[model samples]
Target: MYWFLLLMAGVFESAFAIGLKLSDGFSKPVPSLLTAIAIALSMLMMSLAMRGIPVATAYAVWVGIGVAGSLTLSYLFLKEPINSMQLISVALILFGVLGLKVTSTG
Candidate 1:
C-alpha cells in the first residue's frame, strides 16, 4: 500500500511539473489551479507513504520517479529533445530505484 501510494505521489509530481509549464508562470488560471491541487495531493501521498517506508528510501524513489516521469512527459507531449545520454541517465535512476525497493525491508 505504501509503495503504491509512493508511486502515485511520484506520478502526481510529474503532473504538477507539467501543469506548471502549461500554467505559464501561473498566468493561466485552470492549469495553475490544477497544478496547485496536484502539488497538494503529491505531498499528501508522500507523507502517508513515509509512515511505513524509510524516509531516505522513500524520498529517493519519489525523486527518481518524478525525474523519469517528467522527462518522459516532456519528450512526449512537449516535444522536448531527448538525447542518448539523458536516456541512459533515466535508466540508471530507474535501476537505482529498483535496487532500493528490493533491498528495503519495509
Candidate 2:
C-alpha cells in the first residue's frame, strides 16, 4: 500500500509539472489551480508512503517516477520531440528505480 502511494505521489508530481508548464508562468488560471492541487496531492501521498518506507528510498523513487513520467507526458501533451539521448536517460532512470525497489526491503 505504501509503495502504491509512492507511485501515486510520483504520478501527481508529473501532473503538477505538466500543469505548471501549461500554466504559461501562472498566467492561466485553470492550469495554475490544477498545478496547486496536484502539488498538494503529491506531498500528501509522499507523506503517507513514508510511513512504511525508508525516507531516502521513498523520496528517490518518487522523484524517479516524476522525472520519467514527466518526460513522456511532456512529449505527448506538448508535442515535444524526444531525441535519442533523452530516451536513454529516461531508460537509465527507470533501471535505477527498479534497482532501488529490488534492493529495498519494506
Candidate 3:
C-alpha cells in the first residue's frame, strides 16, 4: 500500500510538472490551481509512504519516477527530442529504483 502511494505521489509530481509547463509561469489560473493541488497531494502521499518505506529509498524512488515520467511525457506531448543517451539514463534510473525496492525491508 505504501509503495502504491509512493508511486501515486510520483505520478502526481509528473502531473504538476506538466501543469506548470502548461500554466505559462502560473499566468493561467486553472492550470496553476491544478498544479498547486497536485503538488499538495503528491507531498501528502509521499509523507504517508515514508511511514513504511525508508526515507532514503522512498525519496530516491519518488524522484526517479517523477523524472522518468516527466521526461517521457515531455517527449510524447511536447514533441521534445529524445536521444539514445537520454533513454539509457532513464533506464538506469529505473534500474536503481527497482534495486531499492527489492532491497527495501518494507
Clashes of each: 0, 0, 0
Give the lDDT of residue 43 in candidate 1: 100
Q: Write the per-residue lDDT of candidate 1 for residues 1-106, one digit (tens) a residue.
A: 9999999999999999999999999999999999999999999999999999999999999999999999999999999999999999999999999999999977
RMSD to the true structure for each prediction, in A, is 0.6, 0.7, 0.7
Q: After superposing candidate 1, which stretches have Cα over 4 Å from the reference?
A: none
What local distance difference test score does each model get? 0.97, 0.94, 0.96
TM-score of 3: 0.97
Give model 2's clash tally: 0
> Which candidate achieves the best TM-score against the true structure?
1
User: Which is the winner by lDDT between candidate 1 and candidate 3?
Assistant: 1
lDDT of 2: 0.94
Local accuracy of candidate 2 as per-residue lDDT tens digits, 1-106:
9999999999999999999999999999999999999999999999999999899999999999999999999999999889999999989988998998889887
**Candidate 3 lDDT tens digits, 1-106:** 9999999999999989998998999999999999999999999999999999999999999999999999999898888899999999999999999999999998
Worst 10 residues of 1 by lDDT: 97-106
Clash count, candidate 3: 0
Q: For residue 33, what is the lDDT in candidate 1?
A: 99
Better of 1 and 3 by TM-score: 1
Off by over 4 Å in 3: none
